[model samples]
Target: PRFKSKKATRQGFKTDRAKIIKGKLRLDKPHGIKNWYDIRMSGDKLLTGELKVVSICRENGKYWASLPFEIEVANKAKTNRVTAVDVNVGHINYTEGKINTLPDNLKRSYKRIKHYQRMLARKSVINGKRATKSNNYVKTRAKLQRDYRKVANIQHDIMQKFTTQLVEEYDKIVIEDLQVKQMQMTHVAPKGLQRSMFGYFRQILSYKCDWNGKKLILADKYYPSTQRCSKCGHIKTGADKVGLNGNLKHGTKHNEYICYECGSVMDRDENAVYNLLALIN
Candidate 1:
């Protein structure tokens, strides 16, 4: 890959001529470079098997190295357990009647990022007419970049843990094939839906399930999981499907789902998960 002169732009290269020694990554010196570098890796787990490739990159004022190893992934033992999940803007609902929300720390990180972004914007406006950037402006920009990286790391960590847990505990997993792009483009899309990482969550869940020998079922995008009653198999149609404010009409609360046919009432997200689970069960 081509390297940019500026530090802000991402630059990286891949090399297979590298090995780990005593927890340090040793790389061969390239042309015109005199010294070999032994970079200490972060993880505690011992890397085994043939190291296929190592990607070295400078990102967000930090150097990152990722080594991919060729190894066999053994299948997880079967438990015959199955579950369905409904991923929403801020939380996830499960067929097991559990709800998990984005952690407080992550939310705070997001808030901080927004604050830093606004600060950076102000600094940029101040620097726009100047020939050189002020030290304070440069510092603020760096801080904003760091916050962006921090939020990404936190999100990735949470997603990794959640996907790994699901793959290990369940033999079959069900999730909606959400039209996330369409939702994002729509004028009246749900609040926070544009910022939600539904696509990333689905991507990770899919690969984890594949790696661990688990079955992942994607309910059709048009499936009426949200509009269907979990207890009575009744499907809400027309304006009754969703209220004028984009909620179930049968319930006063935003997340409450009520069956008109049978008068069954439950949390909307849980009801959706149940409807998704019914496909495989």
Candidate 2:
């Protein structure tokens, strides 16, 4: 069959399952489960593996059975290298012995999804309609889910690439143990941008590091990575002292800090990154 859109392709692959039981298959509507069983069984024969667990998920009016499997592979040795990552709204900054930034793909995707959501809201308002489990509403909801899935796919892809690259190149990865829950609570910035990216990046980094046999070192949340200067052991206090503007500067209430001894202009995050790197060495 010719695929028109990703939504159609996903719908084509959905399972019509009646029940899911641990590792066993008890088929009532075995649409997704059957496919998983077949694939795992064939792969097991070819590679001598086993199916572990079968679970179910519900999203956008569709039910799915997830079959997880385990395969044996040879263990590898550790490589001693270190990288530090700092996540932000527009980009992810990292030090793989040098500074780098990852594209803000998730943020961009969210912006696009937000546009569609706004349109849907407008349509519902104009028609004075509330969504029921009607066919049209269901279809619209599915489309929204598809959009979400697409964004998720994009995020997953970017994270995989970035993590894989880091793991392959560096054995020891250091990252700020960002207080994500606290950030979410204190976030007054536009769209809660900082809160959105921090959690996902940390999750991806953790798993990828594990898979590649690399060490993930998480710096403490209160380590003051951005406030202390790397070049000199100087601490900058207050928001304006750190060269931060607008909502980006969290400690904006106080603005007077001077490195009277060295006379260095301080930028908080940059200072933090430098300090983080200093800790590595």
Q: Which of the numbered candidates is closest to the native, going by highest lDDT? A: 1
Candidate 2, residue 215: the lDDT equals 79
- Cα misplacement distance, residue 280 of candidate 1 (Å): 1.0
Q: lDDT tens digits, residues 238-260, model 2? A: 64244324223543421223344
TM-scores vs. true structure, each candidate: 0.89, 0.66
User: What's the C-alpha lDDT at position 10 in model 2?
Assistant: 55
Tell me the tens digit of each residue's lDDT in model 1 across 5-121: 565367787888888888889887667776667887777787888798888898755778888888888999999999998988777778555534457876787788788778767
How does model 2 fare in lDDT?
Answer: 0.58
Candidate 2 deviation (Cα RMSD)? 7.8
lDDT of each: 0.78, 0.58
Worst 10 residues of 2 by lDDT: 38-47
Task: In angstroms, give how far residue 242 of model 2 lies from its true place.
Answer: 2.9
